[model samples]
Target chain A: MANPSNNYYDLYRHGSLGVALTDALDELIGQERIDPQLAMKVLTQFDRVIAETLQEKVKARLTFKGSLDTYRFCDEVWTFLIRNVTFKLDNGGQMVNADKVKIVSCSSKKNEEK
Target chain B: MSNTTVGPVYDTIIAEVINAVRVDFEENGVDDGALEDLKKEWQHKLSQMKVAQFPWDPKPEPQAPPAPAHAQPTAPPPTAPPTAATYTQSTLSPQSAQQTLSLPGGLLPNANPMGIKPEPGFVQAEPAIKQEPGMQPIHPGYNPANGARPTAAQRAALALESQYGQRAAASINAIHSGMQINPAAQPQQVPRPGQAPQQHMNPQQQYRQGVAASMQQRMQQVPGARPPNGLPAAQLDGLNDATDTASGPGAVHPIMMDRAQIDEHLHAQIAARAKQMEGGGLMLPLKEATKNRSLPEKPRKADGPSQLDGLDDDVKSEEDDEDAINSDLDDPDEGGDDDEDDDETMGHMMLCMYDKVQRVKNKWKCILKDGVLTVNGKEYVFHKATGEYEW
Candidate 1:
């Protein structure tokens, strides 16, 4: 999985917000090109970081976070979570080329981690 | 007492005559044949009257008065008046004696003291008769003897002959003329027994109709109140305030408001936000606070770029406060780029950044934070750092 292969490219793809974030982070940090699976794992990890922070800001009590794409948060506290955060990998980078971030949930304060 | 002397004799004679007539008819069995023979005899006797033969007269007809101009002027033929004795004798002849019949005084003068002229042709038949065509001979399978039963088409024709038919046609014509018919003015027919009357809504429905009409009228009158085309409330605010002032002290304040009022304001704000999310058009009321406040004194527009000069004092102060917070958070010696130490630190930083990013994951996603971080719902120990770098 560490090395890129045609077989890996041909395999099924399930991309998400977390995957994109991890890809951007790895592109910046990892010297050796990382495999798509590892890239997705890292992206999912970053997404959890965002969700957890928003959980604190909005004062949402975390209920659960799962692997196959599930996160739940406390009631009525999700708006603050989405407002003060950004999905960009680099806030200072050019607006057009910056990486995209997507917040999947707010009221449910759960954060997903790989 | 004196009138009784003549009345007894007259009564006896009348009684005998009536009895004799009844008995004779019963014995002879007077039928259609006898009645027709009597009619023919009367018509023949009437033909004998020597009427003046006017050259224009086609036949002898009963004398009648001149007609009014507008009337269809049918000229009457000249004829001799028949004597009472002759009129009586014609109807009472022995050949017709067995027939039981009575002629109206209006048709034969001999039957009454009132001078009634005999109808130009008939001397004994009842004059007050209406002629109805017996079952149409051309229509086969039609029973001529029974007058009551009618075919479907005949029944419909009979129905259309009633007053209701004319009324229905008149109503349809009125509608075609574009004349509004008053609902109350229409005539209603009583339903047949065991049938329900027409279904109609009561006053409540009428009230609803009235309310709907009033609402539509008001909406039509206030053309500018339509949404999307309506003027911004902010533009109208000053006018509203002036009006409110002119209204009196009891008037609601234009600016000051309570929590409920503020809630209304916030509701409008929330609605605007939602609309913005949906890509709908919005109009925000202008802020009077910005209008009244003077431009910051840092520099005039001519002395520097307008963007900088236009910055309000309050915004500059807020930025200064943010800068102070950043400087305090910044760790000393954070500038060192020791490669191996940096790599380990970068890896740790990446890990820490992931934790922070996950913390805010619900609001913002696809993000990384490198400074102080949170991990597994817990705030982790971190050395805060701040630096300016170009990408």
Candidate 2:
């Protein structure tokens, strides 16, 4: 919830992309190749960069249908448990089915206001 | 096909994040090569997830592995194995069989597990069962105050001994230990071996039999009922019946027990019996545990809609979801929270920022944008996604 630098939500650190990046940075810090402070700066830069790339470079769109099993809104974050979800990608209309998916979404406007 | 794009888009983000941080690295007196290593390490970790093709990987091989990785996740249940199905069927049929034997309202919770799933599973079952005494305030008369075992348990012990012979020895012992808490009544003998079939034992006779342990072992597991330190330590609230009753192995103290305390004792008693009947579900696959425990009666996800015929059930279930949302916002999938130990190799989760999340009572609609969505092994990025769901 605390914004370290670049004033971006670090929520995506749970995402595969962010998780992988963190692991890499952890190794660099572990070896003393990069100090912890520099690693944190790298992640802050990542926090800003990934969000920007997803917004500007990616043009794909997706639609999904699922029964909302649970939804909660607190601390400017909305968490949802979507069950029996079927996601359709617009590029070729590829369909993906899952028994359930947990969506952890933060407010998009907060980082931009910075 | 869209996955091919993740490599470039992610590569750009890594390159930019690394390049953007280089000045700080130098300012800290670090070399440029380490900066390059950081980029490569970042890319290496990304490649390890194998979520999508990376621009750095050789072209010929990327297409081969991801296809199979993607294929395996698409079919999750078949991997849960047939053992999960048998566990549910065995538990359900035996309890339903006893239901026909005049065990009224006791197994009502298990009768419609799908109905139960709509509520918080273990937490809801206990409180609902415990509320019965309050509805009829004359209930302490029925309670085993002098430490007699509840007849529901008595019947279960009988059922277990008859069905499994020596195999059910352990569960039968817990039930006997439970009965020792009673000081008032003459301890009754378990039904003699020549006892007639369960069908012949009318409700009145069955109640006199003090049958209980079996129902809770499967009918309704009383969670959080474990005795603190697993001891028959002196009853916390001094009760006259329990004064002499501590000498009895499983005797409950006869005292002025409020409903909550009574619930606690009852849960303790039921949990003891259940511990014997069902071993730890440690062997169950996460997918199986989630599917079976979350929506037990529904059985098959493909037919979830066609099965729940009652509109009332839908309405009640929605209300249950609302309660869960308000009470626990942090855990999106609270039912399967126990399975957190498993590797998150292929979890179905979407991490994105919501532009807006609006709710009109139980009906909810949210507009999520610039999201990274992963369902089934594949990863997807969307400029925007609109979701509408009730509760």
Candidate 3:
């Protein structure tokens, strides 16, 4: 399997957030709202801080019920296995056990804080 | 880190900055309403930034005017930074001026430094209807002009009509008009004499009428018998007409036999025959005659075994002989002292003889006493110790 980190990096480079951040920074440099060099330094630092904060938030949310043996972060989502979770089915109003459940969490730090 | 992850991080930083700005405005005694307007302006600016294309590297030529508001930010600008410029810069080196002057080689060979516009084919096509945030667009093939198709039940009814419509309508119309498809198809019923005239007669009734007509014609052709006691012919004809009318067409006159009168006549003939046979001495009853008639003897063949004949002769002789023997046995003074001596010895001899007979017959029921062996109601005595009997 391809490395999940590589996939995430590709997504960060090409995705909407990357484009939006680059556009905002370029506009600020054009308007001379702040020094280009200082702004670049701050932006890189901000990116590091946000990644750490999101990773922490995601880890906390994942292990809220219990700790998992393995989890993966890929393509803007966190995937992990859980056990004995109850899920409501759409067919009938029935609740069933989801053994070895695979959960996909795309929730970010902003959403979590909100 | 994914681009989706970057969105939340950017939101957090922006929130922190807003908080700092609010604090500054409050310290400067700015109006709360002004702060709200500033917040709205900042949101608008963020939306605009999301719509713009990113240029990671500084272009050698002057940049073109900004793109239309409708353009999406899916494609990277031609003047985007090389891979090394964008991501390979070491965080330890804060010397931006020296790094900018010393341009890195062998990084992102495809990078265009002139900021060229993208080809028309490279730009993504936009949908006719613009969707708002959180809203999904409807399917492109759906048309509002076409009304809703018929339900399942309606479609089934329409299919049935298409296949069997004409025949069903004809049958319904026939029922309303009171017309029968086959008039003579019903079951035939027997007609009574006084009932209304029937429109149709079955084959059996027609055959019976034809036979009756022929019989009546034959009767008319025959000469009438001489009228009794000088009765008029017209009166006789009137009597025949009355019988015909009373019996109706195809009806035969019933002839009833009187059982009592016939029985009396037969009994007279039987008595005369009995008187002739017996010379008026005795007459065998009719019941005896019937029994004899029912049990006719089967004749025996001349050459076959004569056992049946011998049995009849034996039965007659036994009956006659038994009467004579019983009378002789009843006499007490027929024998003298010689008989008395014989009688005592006869007792021993009779017992021996009975034993021998019992052995031969395999039956023992005789008792000997006073020279006599009694069996059932009969008695037997030994004459000379021989198995012969003198009853």
Highest lDDT scorer = 2
Q: Which ten residues in a row have the lowest lDDT in candidate 3 chain B?
A: B138-147
Model 3 agreement with the true structure over B1-391: per-residue lDDT tens digits: 0122223444564454344445444655555554454434444444443322223213332244577643223322323211111111111122321222233420111122200111112122111001111111010011010001112322232233223443333332333123222322211112222111211222111111211222122222332332222223422332343233323321122212234334433443454455457644335566455433322121111113774453344335434444444566546434453355334322111111111212223222221111111122112222212111111
Q: TM-score for all predictions? A: 0.13, 0.46, 0.17
Candidate 2 local lDDT, B1-391, one digit each (tens): 3577777888898888887887888999999989888778878777777778888987754443444443222122332321222222223333432443443433221232322222222342334434332111111112122223444554455456444534664675466446434423423222222222331333222221221211122123333343323312211211222223323433343333234344543443453344334343335576444322323222222234643233334334434544544456646565566245123423888888888777898777788888998766667788888877675
Q: Model 2: per-residue lDDT, tens digit, A37-112?
A: 8778777888888888888888877777787876677998887877787887778766788888888899988868
Which candidate would rank higher by TM-score, 1 or 3? 3
Query: What does candidate 1's lDDT look like per residue over B1-391, in tens digits?
Result: 0111112222232233223333333444434343233223322322222112222234544454466543211111112111111222223332221111222321111122111122223232212110111111111111111111122432232233222433333342333223212222211111111111111212111111112222222223332243322223322321232233223332133223344445543443454455455443223223422221222222232234553233333345434434444554444424332223333322111122222223433332322222222221112211222211111
Where is model 3 more than 4 Å wrong at Cα?
A: A1-15, A59-114, B1-10, B16-391
Better of 1 and 3 by lDDT: 3
Instruction: Evaluate every candidate with DockQ and list the scores.
Output: 0.01, 0.47, 0.01
Decide which is better by TM-score, 1 or 2.
Answer: 2
Ranking by lDDT: 2, 3, 1
Off by over 4 Å in 1: A1-98, A101-114, B1-302, B305-309, B329-391
Instruction: RMSD for all candidates, in order, please.
Output: 49.1, 21.4, 59.3
Candidate whose TM-score is highest: 2
